[model samples]
Target: MQYRFDVQGMTCGHCERAVRQALVQVDPNAQVQIDRAQGRVDVTSDAPQDTLARAIAEEGYQVAAAA
Candidate 1:
């Protein structure tokens, strides 16, 4: 399924990379796009939404909600 999340605390390239990596860890083949300026993360993955969210949270970013 495809998911769009509004994320917080992403300030730089590293932050974007971290979120992307976290999602990849869960779905491996998942597609992740982070727009730091907009505080949004768009994901296309088969993994459960909660699992994906936890991965991002583990990376120390706050996921406000799924869009």
Candidate 2:
């Protein structure tokens, strides 16, 4: 399944990388696409939505509502 959401507090490449790393750590093959300009993340994985959101948040970012 695919999940898309807004992620706030990503202001630089490092922030993006941190979010990406967290997502990947949960599902290594997951496809992660981040649109920093829009504060969004497009993730494709079989993982549960809550699980994915937690992973992203644990990386020090806030996961906004799904879009």
Model 2: per-residue lDDT, tens digit, 1-67?
9999799999999999999999999999899999999999999998888998999899888896575
Off by more than 4 A, model 2: none
Worst 10 residues of 1 by lDDT: 58-67
Kindly list the per-residue Cα lDDT of model 1 for residues 1-67, writing each as its tens digit: 8898988999999899889988998999999888899999989999999899889999998896664
lDDT of 1: 0.89
Query: What would the TM-scores of all predictions be?
Result: 0.93, 0.94
lDDT values for all models: 0.89, 0.91
